[model samples]
Target: MAPRRLDLARFAGPTAEFARYLRTETVGGFVLLAATAAALLWANSPWHGAYEAVRDLRVGPHALHLDLTLAQWATDGLLAVFFFVVGLELKRELVIGELSRPRQALLPVAAALGGMIVPAGVALLVGRGAPGMEQAWAIPVATDIAFALGVLALAGTALPTTARVFLLGLAVVDDLGAILLIAVVFSTGIALLALGAVVVLAGLYWMLQRRRVTSPWLYVPIALATWVAMHEAGVHATIAGVLLGLLTRVRADPGESEAPAVRLEHRLQPWSAGLCVPLFALFAAGVPVNGEALRAVVTEPLGQAVAAGLILGKVVGIFGAVLLVVWLTPASRPRGLSWPDVLAVAMLGGVGFTVSLLMAELSLDGADVLTAKAAVLLASAVAALLAAALLVLRSRSHRRAGSRHTDG
Candidate 1:
């Protein structure tokens, strides 16, 4: 028999309620977008100097080569936390989730590759002779999981689980590719000693997991040391976070309800989504959006390439890739995903906010960086709006279809 709940229970559970809300992609998305808006406003407001001063303010132990601007901390330090969350998710998916099967994973792998290749080609073709074209071409080759999934949650409520998984898997693979590029392309000359330390520390982390050690005290310091080593090696510190996350044990023990990886991810996800990512945006998304910047983005070849790669290339690359694979091979679109749904996801892929901003900072300099960032913001905004509209229409279509079936 069911027991009646006491009225006092309702008042006792708001913390759980608040936590539940924070777990949603909708809340995370809106938080990130709000931070971005606030950043832009503050940067363009009368107190613009404060924004720059705060962002450029450096605070770290210079002896360990850790002294860096606050903005750099957000990018290299905090974003690492976000990527660690991503790595845990990817590991789970590969082991037991949607990507467990080679057959099921092929579609997203193809989509990710196509999503990357076509955008690079588009950027290259358009910005061939531009100053930073060599590296800037890779900017739009990545996707922002938070923004994309958030937009989906808001507009794609009626969409099937298959669609969400596809997008999630695609973005994960896309981020992996971008991480590889950062390691290979954007890095300065490597310090072999620091590189060796990173490898050793990461290996030690794996050994700790194998031994069933679960102390945060030990892991946190090692992780921090690994981050510093990676930075010293001229590789991005975020890569260290991903490597550590991947090394963490995900399978539960006999008496455990959740694996260590799962436990850590659950605890860290809220921080990553609600604070780490938003703070990154607060520092990174403060690019000037004045007429001059907008004009440069629209008129300059480099800016056009970035905008086109994100807005046009993503749609064509992703959608066309799915069609080609499904038509030419044994792969088929996931069940319940229609052509319109695919198109909407393709557009959402263009909402390349986080990594695109990182890429802009990494690849360009001075005015070029400013212009590229402005283009990223503009393109992301347009893509989100268009994708939202299409998703809403698709949602209505789904409702009508469901209604007809029920009536039948």
Candidate 2:
């Protein structure tokens, strides 16, 4: 038989729509930044007691151990919605986007691995011999795509489209790594019976999609059941969102205008961006800043490690990985992207805002937790400012080069 042809047209519509979705998310990033600022201001203001009261207030069914504080619900529940969107995007990428081709996918995958490893290694080295500091190593291993993209958007239209694509791909892979870390590293007890139930529910969910069941009434309950089971199984409940999203059907039926996965992602994107993520930021980003906490963050090893890992480790890891890959396989670097472009993108990768905060909450508690959060906030801000400046300079250089070419 002759070589089989790949159906490239099958992915065109979804890919175009996904690009549009990313543009919308840039706007959401602004909203997210505002929410984070509000939380920080509220947490440190005179009304700090009220903010604490709201965050700690619990309302859920007691028998199910669901009566958690508002902050817990934000992380464990609302963040699941955000992860569901992430899952949908990841599934799309794996099936038809850039990741569909192994050659196209290699750069981002390798860079993400490097980005995560170097940061965690730096955190470990900095936190060496400090009690309870080792647990904070994962804090800087994530990249907040929203905030990074937002910074890019603010840099005007001079930035290369290739750069945006590269950053998006890298961040998605980084998220996959962080999710695995959350599942394996943070989970304490293994509740086998409940885990089995979760597996069963997951199977049922797969069956529902296979049958082309479009009713949310039927699927919602199963999704919720899976989430509850995962929580009870001592696994992170957000994994349920990711699993369900990945298992959803991505290809449309012959007569349909869109795939089920596309429809769900489009419908849920607003909720996830507008409410879920911002609300999580509101609760999670409210680290109280005071003289004592500020002093501790500057003096404490954990804080120093987390900050350094995010601000410096990301640059070294991502940029170094790109350089190594390009040097070993010269064909790996995409045309029109130079080393400076990679360096700027790598700098932006340090903005580990949202998921970094979540990991801090999961890994540390008490003064350490507060200190880690403060460090994350400061480090993320520094990274954003530095990335913004680098990106602006890069954009101006690109514009001037283009103008010179046109004049010639």
Candidate 3:
């Protein structure tokens, strides 16, 4: 008998969804790079002072203490849009995607946890005794999904589907960990009244979602109120986005084409990828590189820790965690996923661009912030290069093996 053909429908939902996600992220990665390049050029140009002026320009109602600079708006306000999408994706995965099954989810979750803890530990060790550096530990714990997926996309058909799924699951969990750190570690000056208002709004949102209220007008105001309340409560406003996203109903009603979460994610993905993320990159990635600034980035403890934590810490932590899990439970390793593949993905996990920049801004100030930003950019670039090289090799190896099997 001929070898039985593998059924495709069993994997259709997740595979198709992941493919769509990767395509959007790949395109967004190019846009993000262009924005970063423009920001750098503008910052270093003769009109650099004008760039700073634009970034520092304040707006909003001063009486409410809501007046914020252009850069602050980019980091705080625009990033919330990005996180909202993240929340949707996370909920979908938990409910119906790769993470729905405990066996399938365990490896990536373990990897994500290790990816976070080890980098933080390394950062803390590297920044030991340095004043004000403790807060910067979270900087390297992020993995920029767009950049990592874009690099993997470059491998084209040679890459394995299993590898892509693994990376996506790992990156999603990594983002979740980063968000938790932001909410718990970075928040300050708790305003109980404002927080209580946020809680009430969240409860209302959840009730509406459970009731299957799909009107955007009704939900939009609630989301805005929640965001404002969270901002006033000294928590990052983006946390509100995640909460709203999580509360979105993922299961579609009868005769519906898609769930509320899927519909919203599809509709908002373009805005998140094309506009929100790139715009944030434009504001966040522009660092005035001068001789003095370069020297500080090189010599500063904060900068060194961030760079080292991202490049070395992520690879060691993620890969080591995978090895440990596989050793402890041999059956836990997913079929067709190899050690080399895990290693390559671990390297990709070190590309902590978007969230890392946000964390640096929140954790440091003045020159330290600039130094940390520079370090994040440098580390992300290095990680991308390393990951790309490893993925290319792995792709070629897979292609050759496929040819041999087919010829047989």
lDDT of 2 by residue, 273-325 (tens): 77888999999989878888888777999988999999999999999998888
lDDT of 1 by residue, 300-391 (tens): 99999999999998888999899999999999998899988999988998998989999999999999999899999999899999999999
Q: Which consecutive 10 residues in model 2 have the weakest lDDT in total?
A: 1-10
Question: Once superposed on the true structure, which residue ranges of model 3 sit more than 4 Å away at CA?
Answer: 1-23
Off by over 4 Å in 1: 1-17
RMSD of each predicted structure: 4.6, 5.3, 5.5
Which tens-of-lDDT digit does each residue in 107-154 have in candidate 3? 998898889999989989987776667799999999988888888878
Q: Clashing residue pairs, candidate 1?
A: none
- Measure candidate 1: CA RMSD: 4.6
Q: Each model's number of backbone clashes?
A: 0, 0, 0
Which segments of model 2 are wrong by more than 4 Å?
A: 1-23
What is the alpha-carbon lDDT for the whole of candidate 2?
Answer: 0.85
Task: Judge candidate 3 against the unseen true structure and give its global Cα lDDT, from 0 to 1.
Answer: 0.84
The CA lDDT of each predicted structure is 0.86, 0.85, 0.84
- Looking at model 2, the pairs that clash are none
